[model samples]
Target chain A: MRSVSKYFDGGDTVANYKLDMEIDDGEFVVFLGPSGCGKTTALRMIAGLEDPSDGEIYFDDDRVDGTPPADRNVAMVFQNYALYPHMTVRENIEYPLKVRGVPPEERDERVAQVAELLHIEDQLSSDPGEISGGQRQRTSLARAIVREPSVFLLDEPLSNLDAKLRLEMRSELKRIQNELGITTVYVTHNQEEAMSMGDKIVVLNDGTIRQVAEPQELYRRPRTTWVAKFIGSPPMNLFEGANNDGTVQLDGGNSLPTTAETSSPTVSLGVRPEDIALSTEPPDTDWTVPGTVKTVEPLGEYVLVNVEVGGSVVNVKVSHTDAGPGDPVHLTFDPEDAYLYDENGELVA
Target chain B: MSVESYLEDRLDRDVDGEKLTAILVFMLPGLTLFAIFSVGPMVYSAVGSFFTWNGFDIGQFAGFETWVATFQDDAIINWSNLRALEYPMGALPQNLIWMLVHVPLSTLLGLGLALLFADLRGRSVLRSMVFLAFTTPTVVIGLVLLFVYDPQAGIFNELLRALGLEGQVRNWVQEPQIAIYALIAGGVWVQTGFSMLLYSSALAGIDPALLESARVDGAGRFRRFKDIIWPLVKPVTAVVVIMSMIWVIRIFAIVYAAGGPSGGPGGVFSVLGLEVYQAAFSTPIEYSKAMVVALIELVIALPMAWYIASMD
Candidate 1:
């Protein structure tokens, strides 16, 4: 996709923008965002299910943006699987080859190949309703792969699966993508799933692209407050701050260094829970904010301490220990780890 | 502070829970009507069939005599046990003939019209126009068909005459074999309107995602409907078939109005509906035999409805 924009009724209001997303051969890039963020809309544009009001999409230099879904040579697994209820597993997987007019012998071979890959070979004769939920998900994936399409598009394929199945499918999907070497675009609102499965995750918000980077890069060095806040399980904490000289200052005497040249202006600061350190006495350096402990939420591996400081709350990840409610605490972040944000919620460069 | 008053405040004004009230209020009138009309009539027939009775006189206990006399009648009477193969075979060929014309032709034609009309802008008007035929009195349909099928004055025979095919024209309702077909055409005119409406509503519920899935899978239009559309619409098909069967079996005024209660010349084209009428009100009322006929109609309908309802 290169500068593709599809407007509902020709730009009467909201214009859905899907930018130039170059998927190199065999790259598994995921589109991650909340609902109505045009993530699925962008995927539909790639699959030729929707027409772009402007710009072009190319499959290996072939201008295929206007191609019909069947002609696009792309396979898609829907969130609901969208399997043909009346068709048996074999027939569902064999439909694309049947469409291509492949002879019977080769068609059966291809069906067997894909079904075996997804471990649904035993389910070939059964109807979709007869299979288990996980089996249906595998069948849907096998149906997509059987076509041997040039690329794959998965729209929240594992979202309907239970937690255990989702985790299992995440690894299974990565393995499949590695084996097939097809450029795939997977869209989901599940941050953990995207973090685990995506080679490069594109974070989108409100029909606009925010950040596109490798999973860890996007997580650790998010370009904006929105990206930081939206990309984690317990989301990165943001605190209102002011920029003065070479430091970003919060309430009390706490301050962090900023590379922003025009440092005289105030700015908001963001810090992840993992980056924030908590203690009883103030840290050796004077760069710390004081807060009263509000609550501690124990999440098996670690305890999340929610601390209220100057009308703003920051959650700190700590080991489960003697922490309790109604305790006064000192909170601090590494100066380099502290992120400064402009007034418009953009990362201060 | 005051626990006694707080407990009293929670004590109650709810006579019945909402779900119970809603169920009783929603279901009562329909159940009452069904009891009075459908269930009550069947109970009346079963009880009445056992009596050596005229309409006014419930005579001595006849026991199985009514059931026996029903079948052994010179003209075939109600044989509920013999109802199975009676479909394509049986002396009462009217029921079979009615189904033969009405089921396949009305269903296919109605579905075709519904598919075409769904995307049309003036669909509501077109749908209402067809339903206008269904809503018209059965006597009107029969009268209208009578003129069209009439040999001398009817427009259809006149058109045949204009085309120089004089021998092709006949008094449609009076002819023995053609009478069934002529009556069926009128029944079709009414029954088909209903099929169209059912099909239209069913076609509306076809999920649009199904089309996308098929398209992605590269299924041709015909293959899509064969694999996906057909199964999804199966329930709708069942509903339309049962409803049409009920209407076709219960129908009386149309065929009688078109071809008269005797159902054409020698009663060769007589149907179970016409048989029920003739047995009840003919010169010497075989009122018990008419009860047998009504019971036969019920027997024909119940199993089919049950079977269709059981389908997933």
Candidate 2:
């Protein structure tokens, strides 16, 4: 997709910004964004479900924007599965082949093979409504893969499943994509799923791309504060502050020295909770700030210590500690982990 | 007594008399209306079919002789030509043939129109224009169609003449062989709108993503309708077929108005409903024979209704 834009309500409302990206062949790229961020819209344009209001789309070297969805050779698994309720699982999987006039024998063979691959062989004769959600999802996937299309698009396919099944299907989807070697574009609002499954993750905000990078690269070096806050579970905490020379002053009256030099007078400081260390004793570092512990949250593997530094609350993740409310603690973070953003919300350093 | 103890005693009873009274109070009006309007007439008609009585007098009990007369009457049934099955040149046979032709033609045309107009701009306006015939009273439709099929001034013949096929023009409603077909065409025009609306609403209720999935599966428009839309709307199609069959079987007003009250020409377009009306209200008033025709229509319709109900 190159400079693709979409508008709704007769070109008055923009749905997608000028989105430019290249997905390589056989790459499992995930378009990650919140609702109304045009992730699904972008996927739909590629699948020829919706026309791009501006710009062009290409499949390999051929321009495909003008082609209808039937001739596009792209398979999409809708979020609802969209299996034909009247058909048996086998018939549903065989429909694409049947439409293309493939012979009955080949159709049967492909249906059987795909059903077995998805572990739904026993469910071949059952209607879609007769199966469980997980089985229905597998059936939908079978229908998509049976065609062996050039690109496979999935719009939040696992979102309807229960938590355990979603995790299980997430890996199953990745495995099938790897085995088929089909170019797959997955759209998801769950950052964790994107992080675990995508070869390249495109972060979108307000219908525009924020950053496109590998999962770790996006996490380590977010291009903007929005990407930083969106990509993590306990999102990076941002603080209003001013940066001068090599030191940045926290709004709560704590000044921290940065290794990276910056000249911006007004900046926002970001620190991931896990990167902050908490200790009962004063830390032997120039970056330590003193605060009174306000609350303690005990998650099984790690504990979150919320401390009141001056007036702002900063969360610190630590191994099991005998810290409680009203206890005084010292907070320390590596200067490299500190992120500086100018007033415009763009990363300065 | 204390409130809790009072409630416990109430709960221990097998029936709550006051609550039962309240429920019956709410249900009685609707049940009584249904009994009076639907069940009462059906029972009265069934009972009247067994008796020979006029509207004004208590008459003798006639057994199934009236039923036998339906098949024996020369004007109703003649069992000479079995190959064409026209031997029974009766109201019942004519109505059956009408059902065979009208139901499928109307429903298929309606389905086609629904598919054509579904996503088009000004769909509601176009649909309303097609459906205008349905809203018109059957009597008015019959009269309008009567003029359209008039031998000299009718638009159909004029169009045929303008197309240079002057030899094809004929008396549409007066010709015994083609009069029923002319009436049926008007019937289809009215009924097509009904089936179109039924199918259009059913199509609208379909999950759009399913259609999108079929498109991505490389199924073109015709294949999509066959593989997806047809099966998905089968229940609605069954409904349209059964309703149209009933309408065709009970068609009297249009046939009476378009073709004459006496079944067209030599009674070639006569139907069962018209026979019932003629037997009951024509000279001497053969009420028993009218009941017999009505009962036969009821018997045919009951099984068809049952079959459609059992489909899903």
Each candidate's chain B TM-score? 0.79, 0.87
| Candidate 1 per-residue C-alpha lDDT over B1-312 given as tens digits, one digit per residue, 9 for 90 to 100 | 474345345545553456445655788899899999989989988888777766647776778797787667635533442465332122255666677678878887788888789879999999999878889998999899988988889998999999999999998887765676777887887877889998888878777776788888777778777767777878888888877877777777886787677666655455678877887888678777778878888888898878877877
How do all models score by TM-score?
0.76, 0.86
Grade the docking of candidate 2: medium
RMSD of each: 9.7, 6.4
Candidate 2 lDDT over B174-221, as tens digits, reads 876677788889999999999999999999999999999999999888
lDDT of 1 by residue, A1-349 (tens): 3222222221212435546566767788899999888889888878888877776777776777677888888899988998877789898888778877899999999898988899988999999999999999999999899888788999999989999998998999999999988788899999998999999998888777899899999988889888989977678888787777887677655676667755436677778888888888778864578888889898989989999988877889987546577788888777677777877788875
Candidate 1: Cα lDDT at B239: 81
Off by over 4 Å in 2: A1-13, A259-263, A280-282, A290-292, A308-312, A321-323, A326-329, B1-65, B72-90, B147-171
lDDT (Cα, 0-100) at B221 in candidate 2: 85
lDDT per residue as tens, model 2, A1-349: 2222222211213667778888887888999999998888888888888888777777766778878998988899999999999999999999989988899999999999999889999999999989999999999999999998888899999999999999999999999999998888899999999999999999987888899999999998887899988978678877777786778787767787876655668888788889988889988898777889999999988898889987888878888879899999888888788788887778877
Candidate 2 residue pairs in clash (backbone atoms < 3 Å): none
Interface RMSD of 2: 0.8
Could you tell me which 10 consecutive residues in candidate 2 chain A have the lowest summed lDDT? A3-12
lDDT score at residue B4, model 2, on the 0-100 scale? 43
User: Which of the numbered candidates is closest to the native, going by highest DockQ?
Assistant: 2
Candidate 1 stretches greater than 4 Å from native: A1-15, A18-20, A53-55, A251-255, A262-264, A320-328, B1-96, B114-137, B143-183, B200-207, B235-239, B242-246, B262-270, B284-312
Angstrom error of the Cα, residue A313, model 2: value is 3.8
